[model samples]
Target: MSEAGPRLGGRRHSDERSSPQRSLGQRKPARTITIDGEHAGRRLDKFLRSQFKGVPAGLLFRLLRQGKLRVNGRKAQQNHRLQEGDVIDVPELHVDTAAAPRPAVPSTLLDQLRGAVLHEDDDLLIIDKPAGAAVHRGTDVSAGVIEALQHLRPELPELELSHRLDRGTSGVLALAKTPSMLRYLHGLLRDRKHEIERHYLAVVAGRWPADMDIVDAPLRREEDGVVVAGDGQSAETRVSVKRRIGNRATVVDVRLVTGRKHQIRVHLSHAGHPIAGDDRYGGRAFNRRVTGLGGPGIYLHAAKLVIPKPDGADLVVTAPMPRRWKALLNSDL
Candidate 1:
């Protein structure tokens, strides 16, 4: 994606947090927006997701089915490719007041984010995302890193997430500044033809086996959040023991072979060494102990990533372990 689009001024529509200050129960009027070069060629559903970060895909699809969303004055499929100059017809919408959108991101947090930037080019912006922050807004979160970036740089075109880090996990997060760059990254991540190394640092309960080198299992997320081990998509992780904390815990390096939701947590828990602070995956006791010891939020950090750049050179990005983590692990991080 070449940087060939007009940079729009004013608050970006992409940031739900920057939406006009309206009462939660208020209903917004219908709108007609003309597509521009920056957003052209994107699928309607994906584009909508980028705009309405808090809205669910199901509800967005329902809006299309109800004829509340249209392209060029006619209903169109979600996969429809938008072109420059095309008009988007949008109907009245009830903003999810439940999210409690913030009118602005606190200047302190924005400044922290600016300082966290790892790399930035014309096509991409990479940052070391904090562990507690989400990649995108959701039902419980008013805004995520993307929304804050949108608020921070309203002159830039709609920013798209090339990859996501779980709210509980922190590391290098990348955002594509253009639609074409976003599409390219999406294809690269999904196809897996190219090897992208995503390495994580985790502290887990008990000593990890020296003989056990890898965890190759199937995973499925259940309603209760306990990912089933043997009955889902194939997921694999390469684990190497980094150090042992006086026989109380083990710090390990985890590399993802197949990225699946909760794969590391599931694999570790299944192997009887759940992450020290991951209460969701059968580590409640360990988590409580970790809290007593002042461990990190989840005893997990997306520590590093190696990705291929547009020029075919490998870009290696890494996030340092928290100071607290270093102190707790006795300099093992």
Candidate 2:
């Protein structure tokens, strides 16, 4: 036998060098510059973008839009021109450290999904999003449902969120699969005649009559960016008590006739029955009770939503109670 001891063709080895892949978390340090002499008169954002060559334009623009980078120690508009001796603070952008890790869709949030099939056509998906999760990235929040969905559906390159949701409030959230769908959805949202129907569920801290209640209050931004107004622009909210949880709290359903910043929270607070766990608007006593019940997140959930469907049908979706909320409720209550 031609010695079968060493199978020459079966195995082979060679010397090779493989480079380590760069991680998404790797980031460059932010550059800061003092505004002096001629550069003082330029817009703050424009100046920063010029200084940071490779930085994304959208990132810089969003920072300016949110008033993160201030001019002369004050919030400046994107078009605000700078002046001499102005100190410009450019904060470093923290890259996503776990970008390399596979994203996960929490099973806890799965129960909240509800709605009618409005449009099933390719390149577009319209569904009502429950409250709590944000629509996009902001200073207070980083990732949301849209981000997770993108991770789940990575094949769709142009997927984008078409609207927003308040961190405490819930309602319709639309996603665009293509550029055309994005444009169309934006236009629809901008149009007032679309007659979108949005609804909410709230547990307030007082007794309310079983009748339709209307609140006409105005809102405006305070110096700290929190929306508040004694005599601001006109805003309206309609509410009805679904049931009385107890003498201490009432389960109310609200219909926002006009969308305003913190409209529900403020209106309910003004009504002397702020939503439970609403520390900002609710009274200290009520907030304390919520906290004692293992509280941190808001009690509000985007219970339901209804919007004009893409195929001339109505689309409605719902998000269920976060596990934490259910745990807070005593079985007797």
Candidate 3:
């Protein structure tokens, strides 16, 4: 069908449109919606899916294909972006037996997230993200940290992720309570990365040399299954030995200079001290042990974060290393 992308804003021209046919008995009346500030940046299809929560997805596309739905009184595609002050003339939607409720976030998941809150003020919500949890859900995933958090905190309409941690790497994760704060954090990372410090504690397979502290190699993804290489993007990590597990391993504090994909894991591995229990990156043993799991298992933990504030004083947050690793050295942490 129609490919008139919904330009329901940034100046507009009106056109006439009709409602799709109603099913069964009484017909439903149509209504006009003026897009508000909160809904400005959302997609038309997503907005429709949200507005009429129970209606089956197929109906929206079917109506779009048949020219029944309109933006500013003319047909518009589902993927079109919505703008503040734009008017949407919505026709009668036959929300009947096919309409279904949004999937309920599991109680267990909600409870886990409720307890995960490490810091919360007006602008931010930080958590000790569990190792095995996915930040966002995929096709096969039923629930993720973001999904559960949304259900847990419905008051935050502009809630969003400030940054992401790999599903397997547990610890200090931040979620912005509003869009403005999220954008500020993003700008801070992009423009003034040095002002913020992110540190991770990882257990490596053997003694990490104290002299070799910084890894300033470039990393690129290759096609041989997958890998981190030296010829791609500039990546850096500053590491220091935190402790030693006799002669078998070393606990190190890894400060990220530049955030890169698999930077810590790959950098340490390349430096001749692969994280213990690492499989793909060539540790002596590939033990799938999840110490703080949301994914598989790894000894890495996001130990601390230093966030810069406009008030001059920086905010520093820390998460303790997982205790199970203490047994590797046979002592309390």
Give the top-scoring candidate (TM-score). Answer: 1
Q: List ranges where model 3 is wrong by over 4 Å.
A: 1-108, 193-195, 222-226, 284-296, 310-312, 329-333
120-179 in candidate 1: lDDT tens per residue? 877778888887887877788767888889888766656778888878787788888877
lDDT of each: 0.77, 0.61, 0.72
* Ten-residue stretch with the least lDDT total in model 1: 10-19
Total clashing pairs for each candidate? 0, 4, 7
Weakest ten-residue segment in model 3 by summed lDDT: 7-16
Better of 1 and 3 by lDDT: 1
- Model 3 TM: 0.72
Order of quality (TM-score):
1, 3, 2
Which has the better TM-score: candidate 1, or candidate 2?
Answer: 1
lDDT of 2 at 311: 77
Instruction: Give the alpha carbon lDDT tens digit for every residue of 88-176 in model 2.
Output: 65556544545434334554443444342234456556554555656654566555666656655556545677666676655445676
Every candidate's CA RMSD: 5.9, 15.0, 7.3
lDDT (10s digit) by residue, model 3, range 275-316:
765666754343433222212367788999999876777888
By lDDT, who's the top model here? 1
